[model samples]
Target: MRIVQEFTKGFWKELPPFKLVLGLCPTLGVTTTCYAGIGMGLATTFVLVCSNILVSSLRSVIPSKVRIAAYVVIIASFVVMVEMATQAWVFPLYKGLGVFIP
Candidate 1:
């Protein structure tokens, strides 16, 4: 079905940090070990999904003039929150990611 195709597309067709060619630098930079790689991948996925949901929900309410800035703010907030949570709960990963996040 079309829905399933759209959902599964990322697994291979548009696989992130590879075929898509977006944010590949961080993917390679932070992934020194398998555990670190998985942690970074999940964090990236979470931030993207959260930002998408927030932007889509606010699309109607936001003015076109500042839409880009608004999305940046939303994405930045999510990233910061994730970073703090990782720092507090998963100090090892926080350390592993090192300067890559900033």
Candidate 2:
């Protein structure tokens, strides 16, 4: 089905970071620890998904000139929230990660 194809295409063909190699530094560095790698990957995925949704919703309203700034602000806010949540609830993992996070 076309719908299934649309969804499945991303799995092997259009991965934002893996396929495009967009965030190689974090990908390579975080992957040393399996837990840390998974956590960071999920965090990146969350930010990407949230930013996509927000930008899609505001696409018509936002001026093209400032879209990059808008997207950065949205992504940064989510990252901060994630960082705080990790520090508060998973202090051990947070400590293990060290400066990679903050």
Candidate 3:
């Protein structure tokens, strides 16, 4: 029963970009136009997936006290990657996304 409850909690109770409403500020800021929205969504998705994989893989090694700091560092690195990629390949998007990229 505990295992089932945990599974349901994680899988059903915590849907993203909707129920959880993570990064709401950036979502509102960058989605002014369709093209900007698409670009921001793609970048955000890439960062999220990559960051999750990396963080899960490192969870065992990361100390409990600094777990959040570690996760932030990992995610920030991916954010920087997205920023550089956009600046190099799509300067317009880099400009359009603006402060929301950070």
What is each predicted model's overall lDDT from 0 to 1? 0.88, 0.78, 0.89
| Per-residue C-alpha lDDT of model 3 across residues 56-86, encoded as one tens digit per residue | 9999999999999999999999999999999
Q: How many residue pairs clash in each candidate?
A: 0, 0, 0
Q: Could you tell me every candidate's TM-score relative to the true structure?
A: 0.78, 0.70, 0.75
Task: Give every collision pair in model 1.
Answer: none
Q: Write the per-residue lDDT of candidate 2 for residues 1-102, one digit (tens) a residue.
A: 998998889776787767566565765676768888777777678877887898899989989999899888887888787788889988876776667776
TM-score for model 2?
0.70
| Residues forming the 10-long window of minimal summed lDDT in candidate 1 | 16-25
> In model 2, what are the clashing residue pairs, if there are any?
none
- Return the candidate ranking by lDDT, descending: 3, 1, 2
Flag regions of model 3 displaced more than 4 Å.
1-18, 22-24
Which candidate ranks first by lDDT, i.e. highest?
Answer: 3
Which portions of model 2 miss their true places by more than 4 Å? 1-19
As a TM-score, model 3 comes out at: 0.75
